[model samples]
Target: MNFKYVSYLWDEAKAKSLGNNQVDLLIYRSNLLGADLRLTNYGGGNTSCKTTEKHPLTNEPTEVMWVKGSGGDLGTLKKSGLAALYMDRLLDLKKIYRGLQYEDEMVELFNHCIYDLNSKAPSIDTPLHAFLPFKHIDHLHPDAVIAIAASKDGKAINQELFEGKLGWVDWQRPGFDLGLKLADCLAQNPDIKGIILGQHGLFTWGDEAYSSYLNTLEVIEKASEYLASNEGKRRPVFGGVKIQALEKEQRLTQASKLAPILRGLCSSYQQMVGHFTDDERVLQFVNSNDLDKLAPLGTSCPDHFLRTKIRPLVLELAPDEDITDYKKIKEKLIPAFEEYRKGYTAYYEQCKHPNSPKIRDTNPVVILWKGVGMFTFAKDKQTARVASEFYINAINVMRGAEAISEYISLALQEAFNIEYWLLEEAKLQRMPKEKPLSRKVALITGSAGGIGKAIAKKFVQEGACVVLCDNDADRLKGAEEEFEKTYGKDSFSSNVVDVTDNQSIAKLYQTACLAFGGVDIIVNSAGISISRTIEETKESEWDLMYDILVKGQFLISQQGVEILRKQGLGGDIVNIVSKNALVSGPNNAGYGSAKAAQLHLSRLLAAELGKDKIRVNSVNPDAVIADSKIWAGAWAEGRAKAYGVTVEELPKFYASRTLLNEIILPEDIANGVFACVGGLLNKSTGNVINVDGGLAAAFVR
Candidate 1:
């Protein structure tokens, strides 16, 4: 239980050698203890350290809390590789937890802590660091300890193993309260070597990094040994079948494809590691006539719905036996997946509150065929390793535990409570909602205007592979040049589209969806306006305007919603309506009426799609400075001449009408569109935001 065992980790951190990223420390340590902690089958645990820096001249220091951004493992932590945050801001958030219940507080506080802040919110254990007095912290739910925790009398077993040695806390949610509980317990037990969270995981720390780490392992080993000696010997359940070797290359290929989706399902998979083995237990289990019955027991834990879902994939081919090649394997597997998903959805619908975020996917992470050993998926090799280690250890432990007593999982509703519990969902939302528009190919009809180009640029900035469309080829080419110059080459495409034509809109949406996996977001910022008072307006003029403005908007929103709702993302549709819709400015009947109609359309869609979490928002600008072809052509110069002002003055003329007295740029409107994604407005639907630099006309109820 001394620091001697992990001094190397301390040395690495001291020398600034772990990595330039925050997770470097955790990743490094996880790797070091992989075999012992099984924290990572290959490399799983992730760690981060936070520090603040001051601006030299202002002397008004900006506090930055750097965290591992996206990648790395806890076994290692370093500098230069973390996302930066304002420390004071995070510290202030600790106040929100004061009187709120743990469950309620977790969601609000977690969202606030990570909300659009510089870094990903610290791990679920971040509140622990905030609560602890130590400068270094380590969190690992190692397989060895989980082996003990998952047992029938886990709490009793832990009490016996660490009597008067380690601090203990009943499992609470993992963030701040968990931290608070551990901190309080540790305070009472000053001489405690470490702490073990009941039924969840382990925590260890010391004044020095190495000492804290080794203490974690020493305790786990103690638990492992205690369990081994106390449990009576039992017959091998795995003795039923003969063992055979599994093929490495073939399994690896299959594992690779499943790993990404699996890893996305569970944070545990980040430390994935692989070993080709034909252990008798695994072989016997796979070859058993009742293999299907045993399949569900192999998941790392019952709570892995976030990553591995609830079901397990069955592989019939043994590792050593020759495999049958068939594309229909996936085809056949799809139905089973559908069945699993239906069960999950029904379970959630039965138990969840009206507003709970719906279950999005029910895909399994591990494939255990009758013959093939098992395949685990993860975000990286380290994640895969972690999932494998946890699952493998659990399977072994559960088998033994079943001999002692029956094993039952928490109810599906209970699992759902834990899964969609606000705190966890807050974390999911706090991380930049996956760039909605990024991966989806999009078709922007009016590509040559300020709003259209702004939305297009927004998608491109988020890494979406884009397809740009406009009626004029030359103007499309010009918009493409500006877009590429701004976003980098090949990120956008030019397509000639007559958006009023239904055939064209359908083709464009299909093209974009197929090209980019699936269309996630669509911005219908294309429209036309002819200013005429009621007396001056004509039937033909109104028809043409409706064909593009009202009709085009209707077509795009309808098509976009259909694709999005079907995909289960409930995708986003951003309409560029005029501020005149809110406060009509003595405009022509066609423009004003069409804009008003579109506003109601957006509102109706919002109400209908709320169930799907498909968000619909409108960005209504007072008057934008156009960079699109609409402005570059005859319209801009004509408007300028009519106003007796130069084209440059047109922007300022619009700027003066706003209360803010600030000029609105394309980027300003761009910000409005960007804010519509995942953050700032998870609950916002069918809302219109004014990007008018303080214009009162765009204000809406």
Candidate 2:
């Protein structure tokens, strides 16, 4: 809760902006507050500053409030992310506003108050910030503050803790009405430094940005200290025999078995990626004896309702039974999800208004599996990660609140109002157009490096939930970290699997099914290259080549077909063959024979699985030496000797050999893979599309 405001960072921001003090200071302070997870999570808080800017065409000075716009995280917020709304226009709405009847209309009026036409829509809470009289305002749902704000006796306790420095506003859904109520409270108590919104969040403001940010820190710190002092005395303790902690290996094994089943049930009809976490804190909370009492008490704050529903769906488990048993896990997960869905439907019916938007999908955003930790579902990785973080924070807040008194969240009606509010729903409607492969789950083998990694990256960009499989565990871990950073932790996951083994291939498919419901596309990209003549090729060399290049494709594609059949959805399987499959090169009998066999296997599978609507295709790529693990050691030396060139000159020689004289890169191969999987050739399968930069020998007939 300590203020981390650095003067040099603020000075540097102002210097970089050429003396736009308001915006630079706002950005600096927003980042400082956002950097602390205790204060606010990613995109959970907002900061605003009042400034005057001249109208572009009219050249008249107009007062504007630059508030944090929707979809921008305060942690990395920039000037452009703060939408400029005409302060006078927003204030004018208050005069004409009637009662709380026209919530949707009020949101529209706020949108119309924008001073800068090109800026994104202002945050839904813009009116709340505007209604305040301070020049700078900060709002955050800090855990410590929410702990005090969400207690059963929150008002009385806050009155005592904060004294006269803070005012309390009863839980009111965010809208024009709530803004007016907040404004009235502040007006009545002009000496109050901040206001605590019951079951929502905390708001602090000052004439300057630093003061507002620091005031928030100060208030939250005080609340945190209050909770610390009352913890042992007031915290509720449940009496039950403590469950023995499972070994790490045992826990992971059980989780791996149940993760897919839970994932499949949650994503039944919808496309969602489930991010699993077994962190010690999550395990401690889920395994607590008091979980049945505390887990379903509701979200820590209203804002979190948008990410995690009002209540998490907690699955029951037997204490002494084996949790890793698939049948046992499946039996518990399926019925639990069904019951949770029915409950959500009933809850929606009870709380929804006549004009409210259609109910959201019944799938729970946060799932508390019996023996497993938490599993958060989202359309993408970053969102899932954000939800997981928020839920973890909520757990802490609820624990703290229980320490003081009973934890009490807003009533169900208020939660529904926030969840289905026009402003909140608009965020989803405002998302950019989805790509062709959006929400589809894709499994890519050999994803540790080379063309497989490139394919994984492309699928992620197209909005596919990707599963990366490789035999090299270390490389797979590295790829997972790299992709998680680039695409998001939810977008792709890495699994170690030897594609040559049937069991390994089956496990890979199961991982994909659990991680992202089921697979929509499978790219068999794992292979090895051996340049040896028929006379010189040893039996071991030949067998190894066939095991990886030919048999591996057969195993993975077969398993993928089974998963697709179960889902009753047509899918695509693209094999990464090579130009050597069609046009045999000198001293490449071992490699060429295996690839040629793989190409034929793809055609055979296509002919058989097409009845199930499973399309099979192959991309024959040539000499993609860059980052190719297959092109190292003996393969590199042999290829250079075959071309009568040095190792360094091999790439140039291969490029010159092509009719287009182009050097094929891994991304070029990935493009061909995307073409096959993205429905470009939906009706045409059992085809080999050459990605060899126009090699006539490798052209399809």
TM-score, every prediction? 0.48, 0.87
Model 1 lDDT tens row, 1-701: 24322222335545277454434554454446544434533223444445435644576756444444333444443443344445565667656666435535553454454422445434555566656565456666565565555555666656676886777776555556666788798889888776766545577765444555666667766665554554444444533455444465454443333322222222221222222223455556666543555555433343343444445566444343321222333344456556655665686788898768766544445556555455554322233334544556555544534433333333456566667876567666755644544334455667665667777777677656566877767877888788768875546646677778877776666444322323556677777767655776778988988888878888877766655543444457777787867775653567778889888888887888888788888888766765654456544565566457788787887778789888777778777877886356877888888888776656785
> Which tens-of-lDDT digit does each residue in 26-101 have in candidate 2?
8888887888788887888788999888977799998889888877888888888888899999999978787888
Cα deviation in Å at residue 95, candidate 1?
A: 5.3
lDDT of each: 0.57, 0.80
Regions of model 1 farther than 4 Å from truth? 1-37, 41-72, 80-120, 187-190, 227-232, 237-294, 297-305, 315-335, 376-390, 393-411, 421-701
Q: Give the clash count for model 1.
A: 56
Best by lDDT: 2
What number of clashing residue pairs does each candidate have, in the order they appear?
A: 56, 2
lDDT of 1 at 645: 78
RMSD of 2: 4.1
